[model samples]
Structures are given as C-alpha cells and as structure tokens.
Target: METDKRNLGGRPGITVQDVQRACEALRKQGRTIGPTNIRLELGRGSYSTIIRALRNLGLSASSKHKGGE
Candidate 1:
C-alpha cells in the first residue's frame, strides 16, 4: 500500500535489477518466471529488455532454461 511517485522501486525507467526482482518474486510463489513474464511486469514491449538483464546477471539465456521464454 506504499507507493512513491519517484523511484518506483528504483527508478522512473525500468532496469535489469527491477526485472530480476520481479522474477525472483514469482519464483518465491512457486511460479515459473521468465523474460516474457518480466517484460509484462515491467510493462515493456519486448524480451530484449529482459535478455539484457539476464546477461547482466551472468545468465546464459540460451533458450534452455527459465521455461524457454
């Protein structure tokens, strides 16, 4: 119920860390989180944003894991 206009969890624009946090949250709920899901959560247009985050996280992101999204 706490919402701030600025830094909506970090910054005005979405960041890789934001997507990663969302993914980790989904995983905690026992749901499979992927780039697509992260994009949706971040209100992004494509998976590229998520891919960038994956790369920054040192993830392979070779379409073999994370539900192949």
Candidate 2:
C-alpha cells in the first residue's frame, strides 16, 4: 500500500543537528523556527525538506527546542 507520491520519511541530505543549530541561530535573532526561515538560514533545501526535518526533530513554529534557556 505504498505510492511514489507519498513519502514515508523526511527528505535526505539534511541533518537534525544542522536544523537544530539553525533553530538556535534563529532564536538568537528573535526569529521564528519555521521552514522559510530555516531554508534561508540554511541557504539551501526546499521548504518541504526543512519542514520534514523540523517535524522529525519534534520542532514547530513555536517550538522550545532550546528548553530551560
């Protein structure tokens, strides 16, 4: 029951730590941790790619990934 139109996982070639670091940098700049910001921060990757990575990392627009800070 699988289809090429549906992907079961996040797109490859991007790292969680890289997203995390980008999120951290965004936080420092008082920006939101959304796909567009992340993509701009990354200077590569599509929005979907960034979003999947964020979802995989349990991060969202209002994520507190850097908790206890």
Candidate 3:
C-alpha cells in the first residue's frame, strides 16, 4: 500500500504495515482500535493517515477483535 510520503513532526512516514502492527497490538491488548489509540501506540501519524491505512487493511474504528464475538 502507498503510504503518506509527507513528513510530520520530523518523524518518518506512516505505512500500512505500521498501522497493521499497531492494530494487531491493540487487538492483543483488547483495546479499542481507532486512530487515537493507534497514534498513541505508534507515537506518530495523523488521524487521516491512520484512517486511510486502516481502510487499506479492511479495518475501521469500530472493528472487532479477531475471532471475538
């Protein structure tokens, strides 16, 4: 997936892989998977950028934990 190339706060780019990793971690912790949680997990990226990456992974803010009810 093509990630946002623009730099933010002097940090590197936020890639789909990054978001996927963050989401997985959040899932393991039973945490709410959203832009705010994700940003806190990664310590970077904008809400819009995180949202786009989550969409690419077929996930949303309201997504459930894998194999969970």
Model 2's C-alpha root-mean-square deviation from the true structure amounts to: 6.6
Query: Candidate 1 residues 27-66, lDDT tens each?
Result: 6665656676666666763466566666666664443335
List TM-scores for all candidates, in order: 0.55, 0.65, 0.73
RMSD of each: 7.5, 6.6, 4.0
Q: Which 10-residue span in candidate 1 carries the lowest summed lDDT?
A: 1-10
Q: lDDT (0-100) at residue 3 of candidate 2?
A: 27
Q: Give the TM-score of candidate 1.
A: 0.55
Question: Cα lDDT of model 1 overall?
Answer: 0.57
lDDT of 3 by residue, 1-69 (tens): 244333332356787888888988988898888899999999988888888877778887667675573
CA lDDT, every model vs. true structure: 0.57, 0.67, 0.77
- Best prediction by lDDT: 3
Tens-digit lDDT string for candidate 2 (41-61): 988766666676677667664
Consecutive 10-residue window with the lowest summed lDDT within model 2? 1-10
In model 3, pairs of residues that clash are: none
Q: Is candidate 1 or candidate 3 better by lDDT?
A: 3
| Model 3 accuracy (lDDT, Cα) | 0.77
Best prediction by TM-score:
3
